[model samples]
Target: MGTKESDGVDPRVLRTRRDVVDAATELFVTEGWSVVTHAEVARRAGYSKATVYAHWPTRLDLMRASIGKICDEADHPEPTGDLRADLVRGLVDFAEDLAGGHLDRVLGGLLERSGSDPVVDELRRRLYEAGTRSLEGVLRSHLPEVDVEPSLALLVGGVLTRGAFQGRPATEEFVADLVDRVLASTGRGEEG
Candidate 1:
């Protein structure tokens, strides 16, 4: 059975939505949230403005779709069942994303415009959940229930601060040291 026919939706409609959302995500990530107008997304996706508007009625709609796409496409390292190793790998990948400038732009855009709109706040929450899913899982598995969130914050915040704020690379040594420090502080310490 043809899935589109089965679902009673046209394949063309699906393609248009996918194209438009991809374009919107690309624009939002590369140029920040301010540039993700319907007109721009329409232009980038090679769709008519009216077509874009027909699908997403407002700028926030476009932004919400774009943010959803970003979260859907987030890539994180696979966990190896080793808490420290998993965290290091995840943080290293995150650092690379930050260093590549895409994640930072997305985060900066969301943070800059956050708190003014509930939708934007939800988008920020979604992004955070998607971004931290892996590390959060590792932390939950290895740490006390009460310490999970704070430890997650400390680890991710350290990486974000080092890479984004301090403009320094989250090198392996730095990340390993960070993991050791957090683990020690949490009383998990390093495993032999």
Candidate 2:
């Protein structure tokens, strides 16, 4: 048989979920998110809206899952301890992700909903955490004693809102230079 859904969803649930998200991403890129509806996503994915919503309860759920899927597909390499080099690589990856445009749409839609929707707010926090973990780990390695937790929010949050709001592309060189400023501002000596 195929996947079944109950108290716990099945593995094929994941596949079906991917179909829905792929459909959503394509629609967001091609038609703009405000114009895309659950019915449109269902048609694109060749599934019922009930099937889509069974796996993704809300638009926020679908958006978060789409971003997570994109990140997974990117399969970005982990940083290898060189602060500047790692930051440049990570920022390029992020810029590529952002410039793909679906992510920007997803972020924008969710942000609007999140102003009054607690579920959207939590979904955004989870998405941000997922995207920032590798960068945060690398930053802490470079400045172990620095309160880098706040930096996690600042760096990624700033990049997303600023880039999206300003319609500015995030360049690797820009981020690399920003890394230098961060190191200097932190007054950190050699982390080795």
Candidate 3:
């Protein structure tokens, strides 16, 4: 007999996990963290609550799995070695994500409950790292080692403020200008 691909685990179990996690992630992205419950996820995934509870055991567990999936699926533009262009592209993409409402919902929930628990704190950190991994790479390549974090903060913070805080569109021109300002302040504008 042929062995199963999932290390001898039944395919049904794997399917259940995928379905449950996918449902949880969709709920998180659309409705915020507070709405992701075992009951809701079970209904959305067409599985019983017992099945979800068996796999996840808690709301935090579901959030962790969903955030992990989000990080794993994060997509960013390819860096072409042009610092200004790359920064502009990255920021623009980030703005779009915020505008799409998915990021804002998840971020709003995380920020609303920041520091209430160690697990929540870890999830927040993971989400930030995932969201900024691309921009961090670009900054690290061109800026001084000491400046990467601040520059990343400035770039990402600017977009977040403009799009999520101010409730305005972070236009391409705005992002490009923001990138130019940061790069100029760091003495790396256009040249590196």
Candidate 4:
């Protein structure tokens, strides 16, 4: 059985929609979400304004689609049973992703605009919650019964504080050490 969203929509249509969404995301990340107008997206996507409007009736609709694409493009790490190794691996991958200029820009924009715009605020909240879910998955696999909220704060706070505030590169060694400390704090380390 073919679904309307999957098999019914033509490949060309999907490609064009992706192009437009990508263009909008780039604009939002680079120039701030306020700059993502239908005209600009159409121009960047090589589509007519009418075509953009046909796909997305409103600017907010386009913005929501772009945000969805951004979230969809993010890496979601899966736990591999070895807590320390998985944490280290996942954190290293996260550090690399955060090091990208596009992600950095998008995160910065989300933070800066979160307070003023309800949509951005919701997006920011959802993004952080998504990250927490991944971290909790790792912890749950190792801990018999654990409260993961504090651990979530620790892991996310450590990364952001180290990279964004301290202006330090999240080297693999640093990430590994951080994961070790977290495991130790939660009584999951070798000595525990």
Candidate 5:
């Protein structure tokens, strides 16, 4: 098994580490972030408490690991040639993932922690990156010659503001309209 210090760790150890992280992810999502402890994760993962600590020494470490797993597991839709449809689809998926119960609460908890913990801030940044990557990809593909910053900002910021900040529903129709407006401003509307 992979120890805390070894690279040539056994496969079993790697599996155990993965199991531990998976358990942490479930705990963080289902329960509040406060409920995640090494002991609880160890019990959920069926690993020893020592193993959990060996892999993630601090609660912050465990949170980071769990958040990383969540980000890694995010679904990104592939950009078809139809930019509008792709943008709408991606935005809707993004909103749903963010607005869904477990993820929404997890994000809220992270934001609450971010003010005091740099590690939590970094985790939030990583989550934001993961969330916007698909939109960026679509913008880059469709507006290859144009600077994608404005459009990317509109898509991400608009969606987040409406869905998370304003607590409005990001329905498919809303996403479609948002995409249309953004693309229209960029001169890449229905014609493009």
Candidate 6:
């Protein structure tokens, strides 16, 4: 195990850390990260504050680790040649929580913690880069006829984020409409 490996951090430490993150995700989704305390997370995880501290020295670390887990769960845009389908799949995955106001709440709490926490921006950048690559792959596949800029992958991501902002939930029907729009815009429609 390398220094970066979680396994190297002691089995007890890893378990305790995972517990904190799991508890924080559950609590943050409901109580919002702003109000969630280490003590609360520790209690929920059936651990002590000192144990939580043993893994996460500060609240930001706990928040970032938890968000990182969520972001990892959201990694999508499976490498199907049909970018339209891939984008739709990714959107559905990313926007489900958005439409239900989960994304807004999650981002709101994260942004508050990140305002002064340097780790937030760094972690967010990493997550954004990862998500952007997934979207770009889909867009290039769907828009092969057009010049696709990888940087513009954000457009596809934004569409879903915008849906979340527009108060749309990740419903099968709404996802279908989004898929239609994405396919049509990307020249994946029948005409294309």
* Residues 1-192, model 4: lDDT tens digits: 113455678899989888898899889877776788999999999999999999999887887777677666666666767888887777776676666545566677678777787987888876666555666687777774987777767776777778877888888899888888888888877732
Best by lDDT: 3
| Global lDDT scores for all candidate models | 0.87, 0.68, 0.88, 0.76, 0.84, 0.67
In the range 21-107, model 1's lDDT, one tens digit per residue, is 899999998998899998999999999999999999999999888887778778876778888889889999899988884899999
Better by lDDT, candidate 4 or 1: 1
lDDT of 3 by residue, 29-67 (tens): 998888999999999999999999999999989998898
Error of 5 at 59 (Å): 0.6
Q: Supply candidate 5's per-residue lDDT for 148.
A: 91
Per-structure clash totals for the candidates: 0, 0, 0, 0, 1, 2
Clashing residue pairs found in predicted model 4: none
- When 5 and 6 are scored with lDDT, the better candidate is 5
Can you tell me which runs of candidate 4 are displaced by over 4 Å? Answer: 1-7, 10-12, 30-32
Q: Which regions of candidate 1 are displaced past 4 Å? A: 1-6
Question: Model 2 scores what on Cα lDDT?
Answer: 0.68
Q: Whole-model lDDT for model 6 versus the true structure?
A: 0.67
How close to the true structure is residue 12 of candidate 1, measured as C-alpha lDDT?
A: 90
Candidates 1 and 5 compared: the better one by lDDT is 1
| Model 6 worst lDDT run, 10 consecutive residues | 150-159
Model 5 has an lDDT value of 0.84
lDDT string, candidate 6, 152-190, tens digits: 544445555667555544565666566676556655655
What are the TM-scores, per candidate, against the unseen true structure? 0.93, 0.75, 0.93, 0.82, 0.85, 0.73
Residue 50 displacement in candidate 3 (angstroms): 0.5
